[model samples]
Target: MKTKFTAILLLQLLLISCSGTISTLKKEYSFNTSSSLKSNWNFNPKEWALEKDTLTGTGGPMHWGVIESRKQLPENYEINFRVNMTKESLFEVMLNLDKEKYIRTYLYQINQNIVIGDGVYDKKDDSYGKRGGKSLFTKPMELQNNKWYSVKIRVQNNQLYFSVDNKITLECSLEKSNLSQKGKLGFITNGETKITDLTIKTL
Candidate 1:
């Protein structure tokens, strides 16, 4: 009798957990405008320490982030945005899980408006590591300071593709990344940066 009761209780708990996750995903959410930023998106403008507000095609945000726990997204998702930055500023975007413990990062920066390229980071070593993808590009991407570039990231299964303006730039794969599955999405910058039309679509 005791074993039977335990089994029944476990079944009930499992059903409840699955139902909760399904409900969370059913709701449609977006963050492009100020209204969306305040309602669904979670970010603190003060945390980034605002310098000034810049413009884009649509609503632009200085910085944005959402907690891993609050997000119930699919395993595969695409993050695309138009990023603009100054020569003195740096641009870094990442998908972080376990809060500040672990992060898989993709960075684009312009220093003195001279060199521009793609960078991957592993939080475990506190270092910038090599990128993972299928193919490699010969020339590094040239980014203009105070200008916007269309960036797209597609994470299908274990493969990741980074492209600029629908052009294939660098392709890499992350086999041992802690963020193997979907979690939190974060955009961070130290100097000055602007992001607009940020969209997260999942398959």
Candidate 2:
């Protein structure tokens, strides 16, 4: 009888934990009018423009258009969006960005940007990093040019959650980092990358 009671209690706790995660997610903000992205979000090169619904970031060194909002983001949050890469092998997102310090804060709740690129699983070192990089996938996992991929991210305290196309790939904790500063969310695009349907939500 005692063992049965313990099993029932454990089952109830599991259900409650699952339900709590399901209930905490809520949408916060979404963007429109990328054509006027310049007036809204901060970007360099002045060479880039919001043509229709997407911000077309051109390639090259200084031309690697960096797009980040001046608005400081909340402590724990989720960001979801779609990215279409064109002929480029890489792109990056920024989290807990300290523009003043030119670096990222110790990720509060997995505080790092979602970086999806060609494979490099074992090529990491102690300083292994992207947007304070957390993980890398295989070359086959690389984003295909001209194809749109859904990227979703959830950050809470010291853990970072990442998913692509509804497929959850990474959940990492920041061990070397400890700074929890709040800053703007941003991205730096290499090659031709277009961003659309960006939504930010609080947890």
Candidate 3:
């Protein structure tokens, strides 16, 4: 009877340990209200606005607008959002953004191409430079202005998986990218763009 009780206790402990490995952190944003957007994000009011369940950013020649989340993300996570281009523009999703490390994945609406790159920050001048950028797909995907597209990105074990509208998918290794284990997520637009239905899940 003593041995049987000990085995049962051991099994319970094992179950608890397994459950602890799974994470339950999640965040969702609908962009339905200005108050929620102000509380959870940082952006320039002159360039971005929240209205009608959408966050819109207007850009022009030599002008790029950015909005960043206040919360930092976990190492292994998934992000989902929808984007609509008002015109031909450059839309970028930035992850693991810190003072020195970041990863940027962007789509050029003019060319219908997707690219991923590492960010370079200049501490002396407080500006960013370009580095280590590559195209994800060899063929350009069809893109149109004034149309909404669903975007999903998953990061796990130093690997990144990206997909758009469930039609095009790409994966890349980040093991040697020197990115931060955890950091903020942000979006950048070089022309008019609207974003909504942002969700994040950590594993």
lDDT of 3 by residue, 1-203 (tens): 99999999999756533331212244343244677677777788887898765789876645567777777778789877789988656888878888656687777767777666675432233233442234443336787789999999899998888888888876778766555556777787777999876666676
lDDT of 1: 0.47
* Models sorted by lDDT, best on top: 3, 2, 1
- Model 2 — which ten-residue stretch has the worst lDDT? 102-111
Select the stronger candidate by lDDT from 2 and 3: 3
Give the TM-score of each candidate. Answer: 0.56, 0.61, 0.76
Please provide, for model 2 over 56-160, each residue's C-alpha lDDT reduced to its tens digit, 9 standing for 90 to 100: 666543344566665666778877777776645456666666643222211111222334322111112212332233334321243457888787877777566
Error in Å for residue 90 of model 3: 0.5
Order candidates by TM-score, high to low: 3, 2, 1
Q: Between 2 and 3, whose TM-score is larger?
A: 3
Score residue 130 of candidate 1 by CA lDDT.
27
Which one is best on lDDT?
A: 3
lDDT of 1 by residue, 1-203 (tens): 99999999999756534331112234444443445344554555443322222222211233222212245445676766677765334455555343343233334343222212233433333322322221122335566568877878767776666667775355445454334354555554554566665556675
Distance from true location, Cα of 190 in model 1, Å: 1.5
- Candidate 2 stretches greater than 4 Å from native: 1-30, 34-36, 45-47, 61-63, 100-140, 175-181
Model 2, position 167, has a per-residue lDDT of 59
Question: Candidate 3: global Cα-lDDT?
Answer: 0.70
Which scores better on TM-score, 1 or 2? 2
